[model samples]
Target: MEEILGILTQLGLTEYESKAYISLVSLINAKADEISKNSGVPRSKIYPVLENLEKKDLIKIKQGRPLEYHVIAPEISLKNYEENIIHNIHILQQKLTRIYEEKLPHVNTPIITVEGLDKILKKEYEIIKQTKKILYLRIGFILPSEIENIKKALNKLINNGIKIRILAVEECEIDGKVVSIRDIFEDMDVEIKYKQLPSAQLIIRDYKEMFLVFAENSGMSISNSNMVGLFNTYSVIISNYLSAFNKQWSKL
Candidate 1:
């Protein structure tokens, strides 16, 4: 009984509606006073609530001196809910089209140069966490030990179903998930094609939003985020660079 009531609520039936319907189902063709008592709702509220249930098409009202309510079966009530969901989605589509037609671009470039050591790390960590597909990492100048947390983020991305490709300089050690990395590159799931650049560090998402971090030697970055600045929507250029990079690297 509780399970059925729970499912009814999950399907968007109000508390009063589910109780009112359930009470009518057991009593079968009940008037307001009887339904109010069985449903634990007060007499004054039962009639108006029943009106709502009828409007939802979950109940039928037969008028007499006092109106009697009948509960529609689950199959019929659920069909109403399914139709309601579709109708709501169609309405949302229309609303979205109107907003898109009216929306305008902002005047300023949406870029920020973050400062401070911990805040920098936190920001970079956050952005990496939000990545959905593709983390192209190439850290030739920095030793594996220097980029531990960043690599951890990369590993986390790969495990969470984000396709990853690492273009390591042939000499660099495999710092994270070597087997899964090989699995992705060997098949089309993640094509990791690398060319040896002297020292070009890059991390990108969807080949569209990219970050090119310069290897700053001899200074421990006080803030991780402060060290890196993002350049957005340069994927065409990045792709062309990756193409040239891959073409040269694949020669081996």
Candidate 2:
């Protein structure tokens, strides 16, 4: 029953409301006091929980001697909740679009210089997080040691429905987590491209934005002076890079 409440919560039920509803189900018709006793919620809190459920049409409060509450069937309540959530999401999205239109600036160029490896990698994580379109990555030094953080970033990107294209550097052999990532990307809608590259840790987000990172040494250096630049524009140099990537993509 506890696990069932959790499932209901996942479907967008408030914890108290779900418990209240489930408690109501165990009775032919229940009052708030009975619901509180059965559900282990205090009587004081159960009334509000019942009221919320009643407002959603999940329960009917019969104004009888004791005022009994009856739960509507699961199908009805679930559908009602689903539709409510969908409607709420649409309304929220409309507000978000208006906010974005007002707040976001139109940019002229994409150019930034990154100094330290840490800063550059942090920038990489940010771009991945903010991606709303596509992400094309040509990774030559995707070391196994750094796989976890990279995977975490990519997972967040993929979850947001971003289109992902990845070209693994042939020299950067990997296993375990890397292989798991490959399998995930291949299976999901994310596109995977493999290549043998010499250098250049390249990330292109939505084609219009690009960044280049090259390691100064074996590990991502801790040099505070090292910086990674985020550009709102791409360069002609990126055209050459894309052209080569396309050629390599043809082989696979």
Candidate 3:
């Protein structure tokens, strides 16, 4: 059946090998020609397919005048397949997790100043995307045009089971419409606290990296020339900001 063939392929069998094995299973024991005829595989391909099945431990050859192929029981073969798969997955997980946790070489300067509003927003999105476990945000007034972008990024992390905590300014005016920053993200899985914040925003990712945005003027849109950003992967600076953020967060 088509479904059985699909399942066999998923278990690491080639299509021809699966067909040949199924035919041999039905016959209990068969010659290559008989397997080819029963499985609708070309005669030229059947011998190689049966040999591959034998190598995979799904079939065995019964020595005879004309060598016969015998199918291994599905229960036994599949149990061995499942155990191999689990062992491989465990090995991969251990190796990849070590690589993921390894620290990178430090640069000449740990802190880098980023200019332009658009570039700062791009860095924020990039940092958040790299977050593996948790994120912390102390948000200032953001332009309406960019709020959706931030929300979408955070939503993706939430869906991935990343823990996110936010501290947002009470409200901001967007094109003559007053919007509550908390209300915008309330539908998401993140926890948010409200307070009036200054014209700077702070974001920390997994306590490994930090991004800070500062606007020179109050009550002005952050998309203006006065916006500047500071970014760093320095552990000490990240810890300090995280402490301050937690202190402020507890008050709200």
Candidate 4:
């Protein structure tokens, strides 16, 4: 019962509404007073909750001296809810993507410098989330501690139908230990190529935005090294960087 209520809330129902709906489903057709008693919802709130459930198409109302509500079959209710949710998601994604693209050229500064490994990783995740179609990444090294989190995000993007291509070193020293970059990410549903690269990392998103991170020392541990990153959405800059990335990709 608790699990069903939890699932209902996750699908965008309030606690009161979920409880009332569940109670009504059990009763099949019940008056507001009966629903309030069975659902533990206060009598004062039960009518409003039921009205909301009716508005959501989850329940039907029978008009009379005392209003009675009937639950929509679970299969039909859930299918309708799922379709509505998916339609809303696509509408929201399209709206947000348009706004993001429109604002790119108007950014006051094309490039912003970021400092620290944690901040760089956070920026990387943020940029990846904004990618609409494809993500291209090349990294000479990754911090040993954060690789798992990166892989998880990449896997999610792949599952969302984002095409991802990664270029990484075969092995690199991180925190004084040799780490195999290929073994960590190659198993995921992404195209990856391994090569020895300079002490830098690059990410291109949808061929429109670019992020580059540089290490102060190639020999130093990446986690402890001084890291600086530059992010921009300038089309010309992205184009130049992509050309270089494709050149390296061909060699691998």
Each prediction's whole-model lDDT (CA): 0.62, 0.69, 0.82, 0.87
lDDT of 4 by residue, 18-111 (tens): 9999998899999999999999999988888999999999999999989878999989987998999999999998999799787875664548
Deviation of model 4 at 208, angstroms? 1.6
The 10-residue segment of model 4 with minimum total lDDT is: 216-225
- Kindly indicate the candidate among 1 and 3 with the higher lDDT: 3
Off by over 4 Å in 1: 1-11, 86-177, 180-182, 189-192, 195-252
**Which stretches in model 4 have alpha-carbon errors above 4 Å?**
1-94, 103-108, 218-220
Per residue, candidate 3 scores C-alpha lDDT tens digits across 99-141 of 7556532432368899987898899898888788999998877
- Cα lDDT tens digits for candidate 1, 1-252: 888789878877788878888888898788899999999978888888899888888788998988878777858776876899799989997889457433412122345554444554565566566576666665443433336676677668767889776675544323221222233334344445544454435665655455555433333221122254444444455677578655665675
In candidate 3 the C-alpha lDDT for residue 132 amounts to 88
Cα misplacement distance, residue 79 of candidate 2 (Å): 32
Clashes of each: 5, 11, 0, 0
Tens digits of per-residue lDDT, candidate 2, 1-252, equal: 979999978876798888888888778587778899998888878888888888878889888777788888868777877898899999998899668534434434546677665677777787776567788888765544456787778777778777788887544433322223354345455567666564457887655567777543324322223324444454465667788777887889
Score candidate 4 by lDDT: 0.87
The Cα error of candidate 1 at residue 93, in Å, is 7.7
TM-score of model 3 vs. true structure: 0.57
